[model samples]
Target: MKPSLQLKLSQHLTLTPQLQQSIRLLQLSTLELNQEIERFLLENPMLERDEPDGGEYASGPTPAAGSAQDGVNGSEQPSEQDNRDAAHEEQQGIDWSDTGSAPGASSTRDRDNDEEVDFQEFQPAETSLREHLDQQIALSQMCDRDRALARLVVEALDDDGYLHQTLEELLALVPAEHGVELEELEIALRQVQSLEPAGIAARSPQECLGLQLRAMPEDPVRKLALTIVEGHLELLAERNFARIKRLTGCDDDALRAAHALICSLDPHPGARHGSDDTRYVLPDVVVRKTRGRWTVGLNAEAMPRLRINQLYASILQQHRGQGGELPAQLQEARWLIKNVQQRFDTILRVAQAIVDQQRQFFDHGAVAMRPLTLREIADQLELHESTVSRVTTQKYMATPRGVFEFKYFFGSHVATDTGGAASSTAIRALIRQLVEAEDGKKPLSDAKIADLLGQQGIVVARRTIAKYRETMSIPPVSQRKTI
Candidate 1:
């Protein structure tokens, strides 16, 4: 075996660096792709940012967000909001578009060419839950000892304003030298609970609602609400009005009123004071109707305008093969530029294909969505299923309905009696419709929902319906029922 020296011809697939970059760029989300471009710009001296210009891709100076219908029409003219969003995205150092023009792009130059300059305005700081509570405690008319004890209690409370630690546990956190007692801590807890946001500083949700109920005026509904919150909260959550009546001896009208009152209380008071960081999604393509037909356009903001450095290019051209790595860098930069363009081109093609298949979804919402598969799209586009999968992974489409990931358009199918198939998305949408339109006194169960779908020629099992419902965060019939 060791002496064998016979040569055999073989062929295997190989991935070039350029091909690898193209594949990677295709799979990355718009944000990730932009980040990769920035890295390349830093690493490759030949690569540079291409300043957006009119007659090409017009980068508007405004930096404000726009609605789905911002640039839908045949007009390239951007609204004021669109211009602002485009400019803001550029300033944020995030390339959000791949289209030649940004989503909210406007003209690059000013008509007057006035020497007007832009100013950066400072946004006020957002206070955290602890900071908010501390401010309130500071302003309160409490003794230093009480204030310190209350501050300790506030520290023990979680972001949801619930005190998860028991009095003993909290007491242990206190130093033995502080001389803090259980009663003192209880008094401090009451002080914090009595602060603004009625349900704050409660040990449990029941106590939170009960505190709010206790603060309300002494009406029969308030009393009943408090009683229910403190004792029959589980029954109330289950929506078992019958059992509630059996236990509390209340009539339908009274229980309904009390239930309404209970619903008004906030379960998480501290959540209002919690830091709210809204993450805005930048769609890779914009879907809109033009002349009664749906069309997909790449987002220009998501596109990082890249170009080779002319100075370096000229020098390299004059001294070919002399700069050693410079020649390779230039070639690599060109590959990246071509690859980026190809990446977006591939993305646009896949997204358009998806829109074509899910046209019913765009026209009549999710309920009208038909069955779709990566195989169907791949076959139509003459691409591998894995390529289609990569294209749709982190890519997003901006439809008039809302911003949705490319993956949302793909789902399992349920067989129909007429030999047709319905998308799982559509089935879930149907379930939601059925549940929403159900009578409050008797909500639809999974079995009933399944039967309802069966009548519609869509064969979905009760368990499957339940699973879809759970995924949608919809409650069971027992929890959905009302008086």
Candidate 2:
């Protein structure tokens, strides 16, 4: 085949640099956006935080649209009432204050508790599992041999606090010159196991449970729990309560009590002190109920207050285009500022739209959630479906119910008999309710749950119910069965 030059007219789509930046900013989580802004702030001298009322800059980045949300440009000043109203309007949310209150006028209980110490004042947040174990070992009155051996075992422990290495392995780990033996290592292991969290230094899950059960005060339930963990743990896990009952010679009530007691024990006690990889979330918007109407606004705290640097602005105004790269930097800064503002505005608009649609969910919980799709929200907000998708991804909203990703409100639908639809989330909620209310003696199977939903005129297949159940981390009917 021969190739020839052709000049047929063709149409193409191109994204401008500013539009690309807007799209990029919209997709980033609050933390990631702040990081991007920090880079821009460092690279571009003309771009700086606009702090007002002598306040520090917001740690998050949602872009400050005005001079400062709270501060006026130059001429007019807002009244105290106006300032209060503006602050409220900017951070519209339920008056759901944090549970932590300022130490109020001391009550008798408060006065009595005043003498006690608090964790914050005593311990730092960065303390790790290894460090915590080391501290406990230091305070312990073990002999030198025991201490050294215990420290060695502590070092070998997994983050979940299990000593995966057996006594022989641990003994082999010791220095030949130290004269450490298997018996001493065993004693040292016991010493570590007896620490604050009841299940540390265990060789296996069975031992872990046994250790926790032994720590409890002497009681029949505790005795039964110890019996179960010591031998019938596999039986308990398989939900073979009938066999357990026959073997233990315990009635339903006694077995139930024992099961409940065993359930209360922490399987992985050391996990709480493991490497803290907690990801902090800064919600882009907060949904609130004001005057009996659901409302939403930008979370001011999550948005970085950005404004053109006055010094840079004045320099550019006077120097005009003469200041080589300064003009370009100023232009770049302006683009960033505009894009950031647009990013946040888009987030707020999308979040408000979501809150309006999912208001039933807020009032009556997940069961009342209606089926939603990206197209529905896009059409309602007059935005492209892709734009809505970008807005929802990684964006979050703080509501009275809880903080949830923007995407959580959107899900596929299931048809109902009334020629309507039900959200997968709502169906999941219904499934959860049925399971929770189900008799442990004969837990509802996936097929049974589907039939139950069908009875309510909402059609859900058994496999779909099973899928939803698995997603929710619920066990199957066999695993869920109890005495």
- Top candidate when judged by TM-score against the true structure: 1
Candidate lDDT scores, in order, read: 0.85, 0.85
Tens digit of per-residue lDDT, candidate 2, span 77-195: 67998689657745875342454322342465577687675756867567677789889989989877788888988999888888888889878877899887788888888899888
What is the model-wide C-alpha lDDT for candidate 2?
0.85
lDDT of 1 at 339: 89
- Taking all chains together, each candidate's TM-score versus the true structure is 0.84, 0.80
| Over 4 Å off, model 1 | 1-9, 54-121
Count of clashing residue pairs in every prediction: 17, 2
Query: 100-210, model 1: which lDDT tens digit per residue?
Result: 554434345342333354332346678777788889999999999999989998898888999998888988988999898899988999999888778888988888999
As a whole number from 0 to 100, the lDDT of residue 392 in candidate 1 is 94
Q: Indicate the worst ten consecutive residues by lDDT in candidate 2.
A: 96-105
Instruction: Estimate the Cα RMSD of every predicted model relative to the unseen true structure.
Output: 11.1, 10.5
Model 1 earns a TM-score of: 0.84
